[model samples]
Target: MTFAKIELTASDNAEFSNIGDETLDGLFGSNRTMPAQGITEFYGASGSGKTQIVLHLALFFLTHSNNPRVVYVSTESFFPIKRFRELLQQKLTRDYENGSEKSADKSKTVEEYGNRLLLTHEPSVESLMNCLTVRIPKLVSECDGIKCVIVDSIAAVFRCVRKSEIPYDERSRILFKMAAALKRLSVEKGMSVIVTNQVSDIFPNDVFHVNQRLVADKKPALGLSWSHCVTTRILVSKCDPMSIPVTLPGGKQSQLALRRLHVISSPFCPNSSTFFVVDSNGISSVHENPTL
Candidate 1:
């Protein structure tokens, strides 16, 4: 069957996001390429800074190009005011130190930018989807330019599944609906969508541990659905069992940074999954890949 091809917008010569630095490659699409507009799901344990990464990406889009407005929706009820405050302060500071530092016309342009970066907190999948399809589109139509959107954590929507009075198959269908809907919205609006997921420690039972491959067959159906819906699915987990301490700016407050890396479960990955770590400097790829 012959199919008609739609011409892709020339990426508007949108500069490719500077993905990697010294250590982390796929830290932010470092080794891998990012789709202009599609589903990107990051599955990791608690406190992996997955939400922070998505926020950073949105902030970059807003500050770098004033035209591309970013909409961030939270499904986990994980919207923290402190994080947004920190981000706002940083962006404003950057405004003060505008290029050249010579222009006396410290006009309203910079102030407007801070406002342009929109953030919405939706507590449920139903409400989130409503905002996405009805509210966001209208905002784009009436508002000046809106470009990118980041959903803090998509998996949180599933939490309602257990609470849902609906049937099992219906719940699964609901999950797929949101995923597919988000994909369509991203494509239609020429915006990028990044989602985060919660993962369970899935390993082969001790008896079946002799051969690791045999154990992998036990992956959960939920994980399978996530794989099917998202364009890119990356699994992130701790590489080593030993906890590593990381010092923060305050000089005393520190975090037990997880020495985790990406484990590619998708069939597309050939170079094994990439090892990544986020520490004092930020997210980075580890030098050597950890062994199973």
Candidate 2:
């Protein structure tokens, strides 16, 4: 795979690229979740809705636009195809119900929307590098409307290196190279690039904290070097279970679980947090906290 030199105009190099969702955009700060010519990272522990958020964004770009497409690179064991299809179907149904359209041809819509998403699996660091720096650029050149590129949990590939014989510095160097390639792609191709990261526990060495029996702090993987590559850093964590009383169809009451999304660092907005829940219809019920 190879990259083509595409010249970008001033307007194409705007400050920020809007995903066209107000609530999702507002989750970052006051402005867009990411820079127009940079990278945004979503880091969190397992079951923190990292994959869910990225899949939702990919669906949005695929369904909302006429010709734009998204390239999702997965490093995990497998991409969540069932969840993605469910989200896509729900989105189509919801749009049809909300709009004035009388007829709902979901099959055709699903085929079209689903076709726009390109999924690639990169199981190793070397393959991931080749995909990003080579294969992705080539795809962009051939596919004129490629709008976004997503790598769900970038930490997965690197974790293999840690368990292997590769030196630590090699990981950092490769990370910088990947960052440069991603930034260049974002600038030249005029596409939004987002990557998800894993979290690791950071235990305090101080005896006082140990004596106090404090819990370990979870930080994004790949340390400070990798953190510097991203323009925006968003952390999603499972906070205290929020029980929302809901009335069932037969007058029965039930509770729902919600997760917390925190904007750790961003160039546009101050650090603020919001609560959101992922259901069968995808990410919904986002309640912002004014006093962050």
Candidate 3:
């Protein structure tokens, strides 16, 4: 029997799509060539805009790429379809008011844009595993130009499964298998795998204190096993709202609070942070230059 050899080259891979946020793209690299072939983790406290960022990325892939499609697997049973539509409508209205596009054209674009996204609700670990291993692969093969797969809050399902019932070893094995499957899918398909995680509180002793108090230090959940599977990890936290006085459309002065984005870990970029505001049109950077 003759053995077949496989060839590897850069040309065989799909290029990474820009997240449509200038500051975020800049953080990845100077040239912005962060490939979309590995798992990226976004973890933070609730109300920290984790899901908003995921939605923004999904919008970017759908609108910016050539016939691109994205699969969003939401385990929380809360896919904000109405909110997404509002964001899209706001963008279209902004473009029309700016004389960037015609009303007729914008309506057509909105309809097409909505068609590109496929949202799935998986409430359990077993369903999530089926989605990642079976359904997603089948969808990718059948659909053209599928670019990204996002799992909102990967920690939620695991959290629901009681640790005492599953045991640490069993849980670790399951997570390992899931991570390995996701990694393999990303590499083989040349698509980005984005997963959001929840943060847990940790208390560490301070050098100045003889007795350690229970200070809440928030870190990503899922332990070290899940941590090793990701290519990039971004941590976002809400800082004290910055009140900036601005002139409203009616020439009235108003104050707006911009949310800050923190990058906790990235292999291609250094640890840094930036500021942005979440409006009807989704996330927009507050400053011309992001804080390093």
Candidate 4:
């Protein structure tokens, strides 16, 4: 079988280029989940920082608007505009600290970065799809750039359009419509789709359910159908940094680092998974954690 691989080229001057975090290089020390086309769902409980990671990626594409356009749709209304700006500032500061070439033109660079952010609000799947089908294409055409789409809180789009055993054709129509549109967008436009999802609690053991994501063995809220549609389904959860043990001279010490982890599935990456943390500073590959 033939497989498609991600081909990233290095710059002549040795500048690091990636989708926000450097984890894209070593898969964060494991298999990183990303889809060439179609939807890639990043599932986890609330506070797992799914939106933060996606936002960072979004900004990466946005700031480099000369390269490609990134369209982000938020369903849960949890977008952190202030936080996004703050991260941008931090990134700019880091660039300056590191003697980045662009530091000389900081004012123009900041304006360009701000101008590149093309985020729109869509409260529901229906509203979101409508915008996707109409506004998105035009935006991409005007910018001459359309490479990625981030649908933060993908499951939330179906909040009002709940999963019913009653076989509501109307509801299914909407669901399929959105999915089809997303798929069409990706395949037709050669765009990447990254979605955020919530999980149901059908876990066999409640051992790691302390995060409140696995509630009484309930299955993922969106059902198996949603998982089936996406090109990649990455399960994520928060781990008590303190639970992870590090042996010290005194004894085994625990580090209290809350991390966002991605456990890969078939056709996604590999046997193992990757870990990361989405905090105020933005998404950092767990492997590079200073505490680790």
> Candidate 1 at 269: error in angstroms?
7.1
What ranges in model 2 sit over 4 Å off? 1-8, 11-24, 30-35, 100-108, 205-216, 242-254, 286-292
* lDDT (tens digit, per residue) of candidate 4 on 38-99: 66776777776667767766665554434344566777775677888888877777766867
Query: Using Cα atoms with residue i matched to residue i, what is each candidate's TM-score against the true structure?
Result: 0.69, 0.81, 0.80, 0.71
The C-alpha local distance difference test score for the whole of candidate 1 amounts to: 0.55
RMSD of 1: 7.3
Clashing pairs in 4: 200-219, 200-220, 200-221, 201-217, 201-218, 202-218, 241-255, 241-257, 242-255, 242-256
In candidate 2, the residue pairs with backbone N, CA or C atoms under 3 Å apart (3 or more residues apart, or in different chains) clash, namely none
Whole-model lDDT per candidate: 0.55, 0.70, 0.68, 0.57
Q: What lDDT tens digits, residue by residue, belong to model 3 across residues 7-42?
A: 123534545655555666665677554566568887
Tens digit per residue, CA lDDT, model 1, 29-50? 4335355446766666667567
> After superposition on all CA atoms, what RMSD does each candidate show versus the true structure?
7.3, 5.3, 6.7, 7.8
| Top candidate when judged by TM-score against the true structure | 2
Backbone clash count, each prediction separately: 4, 0, 0, 10
- Decoy 2 TM-score against native: 0.81
- Candidates ranked by TM-score: 2, 3, 4, 1
